[model samples]
Target chain A: MQFIVEDVVTHLAVKVTEPRIDAAIATPFKDKLREIVVKSRKPIHLDMASVDFMDSSGLGAMIAVRKSLPQNLGMVLCALTPNVERVFRLTRMDSVFDIRPLTAQKEHRE
Target chain B: MTPIERSEPKRSTRASAQVQPMFHRVLSAQPETVRDTLQDVRRRFQGEVSDDTLGRLELVLAEVMNNVAEHAPAGAGAPDDSVRLPVIHLCIVRHTNGLACALTDDGVSLPDECILPRSLPALVMDDLPEGGFGWFLIQDLTQALCYYRESQRNYLAFSIPFAQSGAA
Candidate 1:
């Protein structure tokens, strides 16, 4: 489990370097992410672009990390790959997490 | 979306017209092994199946095999408290309309409640459920999910339908 944590303008920006978050490493992923997010009292932006696969255990880990944070604080998952996004969407966890696309700019038609 | 088809015992698909890609592996019911097997499975059907169908197939297989790993009983005859992992026999074959999958293992018998109709865990914002999504995803993505215990081995079968032309 590797996360590149940086102090962005208002919150911690984390880049998840792992490609897969299945049962093999879900526990460690949760522990390490929780430690990083709770150390500072700010919002979080998790860049999940690199993760190509995630299962139910991985979903549980994400939920665990979200629950670990203070209720007032927020964690945003950004750039979720299709496979990873499917788990969240199937389980209805999409509503609970503040998911976002990578860029802030609007999509202008060609 | 495909309707759930009731599983037929000892049947995967009607006789196939063309030879399709197939994968078979016998591995321990451990997380690391499960990951490796799933990766290999993806490789076996990379060009043969669409991405949508492949993704669904992978997710369903992961949930089933990992359940075997997670619920493994303690080492049956070990002197020490070493955990004993079940051995999973997995087979997947491509059919004309879907991918047929079958898995057999001698592990803790699946409780009656697992295969019963299930819904997502109650979505309580303050105390969200951490688990219980595995079986739900399996049931949702696969068609004809059937499970039966014969003697000590548990037999399970299902099929993942090919993605519709433009149903998204």
Candidate 2:
């Protein structure tokens, strides 16, 4: 459940430091993400490059966090590994979130 | 009920005549123990299978085992090594096209029969669901899945192909 938050140009970017996001860490992951999301009016960007695996619980936690956000505030997910990306695709979550490729050096949301 | 054997694959010439299938059994209601067993199983299949296959295996096992850990009541004297631990038995057998896995747990049965959704609900942004994705995810990841209850045990059997494929 380790993450680092950075204030990007207009959005707040949170990079998850964990290699695996599953049932074991989903609750804490949600809590930490919610804390950050609640304080920021800017949109949120989640950098998931270090996450190699994510299970249903982790996916649910992400959804929960997204739901807790204000309607005008947006959320984006970036750099999902193939393993983690597969879960997003399997659950059709790819369509719900703004997913970006690993090589996207910079993303700006207006 | 008897297990189903669908399209058993011929043994590869490189495989030994006596290479046994992989199996792991543990008696614990703790989720961490179940997670550890999954890591052990992944190591057991490390080079023999594709990463996609292993990921699917891990996903399905985690979902089911977590369900067991969260819901199953501690049975009386089922654990010899650790008293009051629930038992989970997993067996994986290689098939011609993929792998067949079965998970057995001494836990409570599904409330109104084993009814798992075959597909996920539509993802509407405003009214999205936070939970109820476990069984749907399981169904989407596996080639086939079956659930049954007998003799006070819950059995879930599924198949995983060595391809990067799943239902959305």
Candidate 3:
């Protein structure tokens, strides 16, 4: 349930530190991410590199956060593990959000 | 007896045999416990099953178990001191083709629509759906999905097939 937000100028780069986002943390996870994105009011670049697993509830949370933002604002999901990515791909939510491959930043960071 | 008939008896007795990698648990229908069981199930069959199959297996189990937890009987759960968490009995056994799973729970009866063939929820971008994907995902990834209610408990069974190797 921890997020590391960095203001990368054009977009707010937010990294999810949690390994799994399931029913256990979906509500709080949504609430926290919603607050962060709403306050910043910038397009988001979400780093899902640490997350190894996510269920439908977790996907719902991500969708809720995306819906919370202004229509013009964007959220790009990156570095999704295979398990986490399947939920999005199977549900066809991958079409709704901007998904990117793992960036060089992840390799640089500890 | 044919070879198939010879092995059928042995495989049916998998519960008592150590040859098959199996998992069985009696846990309350709660988010935390369900999560724990999934992790352990993954560990129990880590190298035995491919990662692709394991991922599918985990996601499907999460949806079914959490659905039970979410629909806990009215006045039966949460902050109240007299809380009675629905108890779920889960079992998984690996076969040549796929992993077979069966779950029985004392939670509220499952709706008829769940086991029926279902499509994904309609996509609305402006007001994107936040839910309703659970059952669809469950049905989409499982085979021979079946459900029946007997007296006070609901029984569910399904299988996740092994991954098709080296398919590009």
Worst 10 residues of 3 chain A by lDDT: A101-110
TM-score of every candidate relative to the true structure: 0.89, 0.83, 0.89
Better by lDDT, candidate 3 or 2: 3
Return whichever of 1 and 2 wins on TM-score: 1
Q: What DockQ, on C-alphas, does every prediction get?
A: 0.87, 0.64, 0.88
Off by over 4 Å in 3: A104-110, B1-18, B79-81, B164-168
What is the full ranking by lDDT, best candidate first?
3, 1, 2
Ranking by DockQ: 3, 1, 2
TM-score of 1: 0.89
**Per-residue lDDT of candidate 1, residues A21-60 (tens digit):** 9999999999999999888778999999899999999999
Docking class of 1: high
**Winner on TM-score (2 vs 3):** 3
Candidate 2, B3-103: lDDT as tens digits: 56675676777786546457557656566787788888888888878887888888888888887776755443454645455678888877766778998
Error of model 3, residue B41, in angstroms: 0.8
Model 3, range A2-105, lDDT digits (tens) per residue?
Answer: 89999987889999999999999999999999999997768999999899999999999999999888768999998889899889988999999998886756
Worst 10 residues of 1 chain B by lDDT: B8-17
The models' CA-based lDDT, in order, is 0.90, 0.79, 0.90
lDDT of 2 at B120: 81
